[model samples]
Target: MSSKLEQKIAEFRITFIAEFNDKLAVLTKLWSNARTSQSLEAVKKFRFEVHSLKGSSGALNFLTLSNRLGIIEEKIAPCEEQINSLKTVIPFIDRHMNSMNEASRNTPNSLLVLQEAASLLGELRDPQKNKEEITPQSYRDIKIALIDDNENTSAVNAKLLAGFGFTINQFNSIEQLEKVLQKNTYNLVLIDTDNSTNPSEKMFAFAVKLRTFDTDVFILSSSSSFENRLSAVRSKVNEYLLKPVNITTLVSKIRKNFKIDLIRPYRILLLDDQALVGSFYKTLLEDEHVEVLAISKADAIMTELESFHPDVFLLDMHMPNISGLEVARLLRQQAKYDYVPIIFLTSDDNIKTKLEVLECGADDVISKSTPPNIIVQQVDSRIQRGQEIRYLASRDSLTGVLNHGQIMDAAAHSLRLSKRQEKPAVVVMIDLDHFKGVNDKYGHLGGDKVLVSLGQLLLQSVRDTDYVGRYGGEEFMVVFSNATPRVIESKMNNILTAFLHINYTVDKQSFNCSFSAGLASSTDHEKLSELISSADAALYQAKDAGRSQICVDVLNK
Candidate 1:
């Protein structure tokens, strides 16, 4: 039995090597044909063959074989270049074919070399072929049905596939195929055209009906003529192989179509603990396209969160080590990941819990019982909203500067810390003098344009550490941290001078605008309000004395 097994293994290796030679010949023929014809149709067909063989060769780990093919592809790089025609490409294909043929015949260890060549050629043809080796899966229980009036063809095809470890069913008629299909779900179906006199029309009609059975169809054709091929494609056959078919070619087609690539399903940590609910959610998330990772373990939250940078999270509210709120909070505390969105998935309808979860920095809160479609929508909406909020929070919606509120809040915090460290903070209050006149003259719209311009000017004038804000309409506040009185006064004066020369156009008339300024020191007052108020008094003095002048009020005078 062991000796028999050894013989089978040796035979299989010989067959594999032989098939490699056949693929090489086929590739050369296609390439040479493509070069000779130099038609768009020929190139398209050649590309299809190259792509298919690349996938097969990569699967078989024929790197060197693939790379040599890649050399042909690269030489024919600009496939659209009509200038050269097939003259150069045809010779290249012929040479490569000859070299591969010689290597296959003479070298004993050439099989390994040929395999490597195939892999390289495959990689050259498709960069994605560089993926890790795939294990050919063993199928102990895969049920499939074969539908064809030709019993001999059906049995032969089934036996060939069965050798590759597929469990197949052979049926002689559409009626028999339908009966088996009603009882079993098949990964594939094989249909033969030999028995039907008007095969193409009948095959097309049968394919339309068989689609309802959810089985992929593989058509067996006696020839690869354009008429037959067109009908096969129109019927949406997963594969169409010409007969007296090469069993290896049939096996390759079955393996290519029926074999699952076994891509690891994306590991998603679903924080929900609900039993079938979590699995249902997972199933819904798994579109035919993406891998999904769904887990219900509440305790391994950190581990899961760390390992899987999920496209999204469906985090449940009530978990053991930490509530979803706490988890979200912890996620936000990490500097590297604070912005990662955590959507709270909860069944709790309590408004308070929802609010708390949101306040704890959850990107969004979604109901556990939310529809799968709604969940996807919510996830998308949450990501979009988070981005918008981040932008709005840092920006002034009106003038597009830092908003006065945020600026003041930042200033207050920074001022407190600076004062604790015995550092000085200079505060300046800027009032746009006669700004009301701009509105009155140009309408509010023109005034808005001026205000926006002023915001830009102020933003540009400030140092990196200096903060500016729109205090109120026509009033701006600036806080200069670590500035001495002299430096603050110089900067304030420069700003006033810059505004005096700023030319604004309105109604085809040029207008030069100016602003009144005020200054105070952090040493004068600990509170931002107090410093602002003192600066306001200085500003009043500037307005009272005459507009467009700077004033400093050491005391409220």
Candidate 2:
């Protein structure tokens, strides 16, 4: 992230906070009137405000505040909805109120709950207040506790998850887990419920207890009954997965749940025969948070190109043997590098030489004699504008992931690279389970929110090198480069576990929806088209077997 861009987002936060406070004041006034008079109109108006606040706060990532507001919203009186009694909602309004004028607002029943909720909103928004809550999660350093009576399953899952950069500890019972959790903190816990005949019952009873320790608890059980699933929800379980779970799916779920905001710096590959000139330029760009790899020899270009993956290339127009023009032409020959911005650094200001440089496929020709700060500004602006253009052209308008055509292009490029590297590339085809029902129940707007959340989760769960693209409505595609077939399938399941936990609200009612994914890898197929077809076929298998599950390509498995 650039300093300017960060500043702009900060400005947006300021505006949002100001607007939020103003609305909150109005909401409080409405609540006070409703609590005193029990007026139906005031009750309806204040309830709408609560709904709006909950939605907006969650949308802006003020999760702690939004969740509290959600709990308060759910307390809306049923009698008031039926117009049976206006007095029914007074208790709720009083309990959730934060009245500045009323001294007795903090009664035993009221508890200043709304006051705390409001304070939490400001705390989450301020970086200095409870900084850890607002900071990017340390995904790599995630610690997990797994409780499974089956020691074999625990050992196997623990080893696999630990191999993929996680600290996983296995406990045979809730008693053992509880003892360890007293002294050590974990990000999440996996409960395999097989101790009793009812599978999830005993472990499900422990979920609320585990959550009290400030750790997310996920239940893995063989029971797929609706009652048991509902029980898991009531227990405040983060996710409920079926038994015979895919190890990779669990890995992906944990990973996606612990998403981090990784800001990638602009990369500039500078080639200048003069050591002093190259070093000077590198230092200037580095100061601006740009990654600069200065190479004197043109032969080193190919070696560094694969690793550095520069966003912009700065080539000396006059090199020892090869000029910038020749290098630009060579790079332009590759289809993938066609969009990579190349600038020529020249000592000569001759119009003919500049024209020649542009003719050879460089985006622009800049004189080496130009001011250093000016050069930095020019390079930075070009990279920003080019990214903006690419974003507009290739991203899905609604979800902001890569559009259909761009994803296809990415898949093609990914396959070619995977083949060259002698590594497998995996493709996962995802579709929201029973999405039409969501549209029917909550309307299309609600359905769109689900898709947007899914798209964001898909992008966040993977590395920057991976590709996430919107296939169409309620459908998506993700491509993982240099992935193993079975291994990638596990990673592909990350979004599935994460998505189901996303609660969507409509008209004060909240619900969560899950997605099914089909994962196929280059282990069995070579062509991109074939790989995608297999993945699509596997996706249908998942949908057929049961929704909210991931199916791996049969051949690859």
Top model number, lDDT: 2
lDDT of 2 by residue, 325-347 (tens): 88889999986676778887654
User: Which pairs of residues have clashing backbones in candidate 2?
Assistant: 248-490, 252-494
Task: Summarize candidate 1's per-residue lDDT along 247-327 as a digit string, tens digits.
Answer: 545644553354332223223446655444455455544532334566667667666543344545567676444567776
lDDT of 1 at 299: 63
* Cα-based lDDT at residue 192, candidate 2: 83
- Please report the TM-score between candidate 1 and the true structure: 0.36
Candidate RMSDs in Å, in order, are 32.0, 26.8
lDDT of 2 at 555: 85
Per-model TM values vs. the true structure: 0.36, 0.50
